[model samples]
Target: SQSSVDNMSCPSTPSTPTSPIPYEIQIATEDDRESILNFLQTFFFRDEPLNSYLGIITEETPRCLDLENFSLKELNNGVNLKAVYNGKIIGVSLNGILERGWLGKDDPYKHGDTKFGIILDLLERVARESDPFKKYPDCEKAMTVKILSVDGTYRGKGIAKALMAKTRELAKEHGCGFMSVDCTSHFTACALKNLGFELHYSLKYVDHKVNGEVVLNPAPPHVAVTVYTQKID
Candidate 1:
């Protein structure tokens, strides 16, 4: 039942069902940026399919720069969600609102390098072409789940599923008609699908042509960028 959304891709993870863990969800504040980014450095950059292909977490690279830039950009001056357990931040969903035609135009901020630029370009294209809000042209608001990261210590405890559940409520608070995510992690797309997010479009890495070549040759099961969405209630 796992399906791709649009462009952001994720590597499929082997299902390991586990009981849900206890945690509390809340909207994030500016002060929490440092802690959330730190957690992502350990889990996302090292594990995110596209980031790994771009050498984002390589020792030779500046620490957390790529991850921070990508995730933080979606902050949109704040409206993020976090999962706390015993006073520690175990998960995050960096969010933003995508107005109609937001993707039909160019991104003002230029990506740092060819690697980043190419990936962003690919995703942007699909987002505009296969916009989840296309059918509901009057639906001006689309809540964007820009980045979702969970702590390694909390993995397999259903932390991600819990966070996504809260995200729905948060989207409603933001007055969004639907929630959207460009899931680059394969497991994430599958999990969202299970949570009832509909897969809209997908672009496989091998098929994403760059000068007629497949530059992002990520490892197995990390095949394509998937976009998923669901109406918020």
Candidate 2:
């Protein structure tokens, strides 16, 4: 496990995995910011419902910006990972630990470059209300998979799944009691379900309207925001 720790934030060109899909997992560092940002901007920077709902990446949508602020702090928290192949980052997972009373506190969301502060408020409220740890007693450790994204070219290769698998191992190594993932992508929800994470809470897109006007109608398949959790052993 110390090996993983040493690899944290280090850009070492290590040996590859034995699997047919050759990706090397390592903890990301500040030096990898540009690479990570560029990769995300090219793929997941504005790919989510919130961003898509506001057209954050388009040339005409002057109302918003990308979701870089979302995971930058998670990297500082030192639990993030990068999946690389051929010296290129193909996937990433931003992770953090949630302690007890994590909800009954000041919101950690930074509102700069956001499309709407209201959406953040609503998300925070719903996430707090849907706290899975609230149902249990003496549960103090839970690792939150804050963000998971993969390159479009590598979508069907289980990159996100492998990144999540590493999250579990990282959680277990850090003595976390469980792992939690907030899935706004329908495909990701299905992935978590296949990985045995139970859907702890869900809010359909139609239910998250603003001023009675639905803001997000993300293509097809991505119909809801789902929170999923799986206990770590």
Candidate 3:
């Protein structure tokens, strides 16, 4: 259910006071695309050579995913996919409105639709393959957390926790009682768990072969465990 954004609007919330690092957490806009991409490039590719998949897209892809064109309506309505620090863009968390009967429908990944379709396909497969679905009470909810990331340089500095806090705030602001995330990294899963997020189920998929060897990538499934704390309450 993670939809795209078209245009981004600056957050109405007052910017938090500067700290030693002078970090600022705000809703991301299209203007922040370059920074976000740069952050991702550094964190997932440059710093962590093990995660080259994060930089799979070209320059054009970021524009398509920018908040200026795809999910403009949601952005205006206060659906926040934000960044942290002085435009360093250390983190991102995005969610989308859910449709009724979404779980019963066939996988939305067809042929075209590119980015959106790819994500839908990934989620569909993950859901079908994962087990222990009962723990994830929010699976049937009408919203999905599409992205959550932290820059490598900023990792271990509590930025991830801040990002989760903001994400919870956004969900509550939108009156969404449920949220979900598809985690592919151990760090992400740990962060979610530390924030009290519970595992609904996990899917291991053979996405592709690397270095002529097949690799099993375990995708962690998560759902909102609590309302006020955004933890697994």
Candidate 4:
């Protein structure tokens, strides 16, 4: 299945699916920051559902620093993973460690009125209301998948699944008790569900409004924002 919001930043036309290539999953390091950023810019920024819905990136404005910073904020956390094919980075799972009582600890208005700020606000609301920490109380820390993306040509080839599986392993090694992912894209939600992540919370876009106007109206097959989580065993 295609696991990303927009075929994981795939080109408009996808390549044939029969050729399965060998790829290695490895931890992304500091030196790989620029490569990861460049990969995300090419494959993730333009096609992510919310970014597409809000026109966050356009011909005039090709980059949104807010989102880019958000994606890279936890790169040095040692939980991020990348899939490489012939030395080319084709997939990424940017993850972060979430401690208990992490909610309400930051200034929600830090991004302030920007489109990416709106997204952060929505995710914050989910994290607060769902309170995954509360659900998995025995554990004081959890590993959260902040971003999951794959090259479009590699879609339906299990790249995303591999990335997520590696993330789960990393969570166990990092002493986390659970793994959580806030999925804004339907495809990602479905993929995680198939991998045994349970639905913790869900908020429909229509219900999330600002000034009575629905701010994000993603296309069909992408409806609500959801949080899916699984315990680390």
Winning candidate number (TM-score): 4
lDDT scores of the candidates, listed in order? 0.74, 0.72, 0.48, 0.84
lDDT of 2 by residue, 2-23 (tens): 2322122423222553345688
For candidate 1, give the lDDT of residue 113.
62
Task: Assess the local accuracy of residue 220 in candidate 2 as a C-alpha lDDT between 0 and 100.
Answer: 57
**Candidate 1: regions farther than 4 A off:** 1-22, 62-66, 74-78
Candidate 3 TM-score, true structure as reference: 0.59
In the range 1-233, model 3's lDDT, one tens digit per residue, is 11101011212322553234657678776566566556555454332212223333446453334222332334433455665666456676655655435555653235334533443455455654442223445644334565566665655566667767776777666655555665655455556656666555443334333455434332222221111113222
**Candidate 4: which stretches are off by over 4 Å?**
1-17, 107-109
Per-candidate TM-score against the hidden true structure: 0.85, 0.82, 0.59, 0.89
RMSD of 4: 5.0
Lowest summed lDDT window (length 10), candidate 2: 4-13
Model 3: lDDT equals 0.48
lDDT of 3 at 60: 46
TM-score of candidate 4 to 2 decimals: 0.89
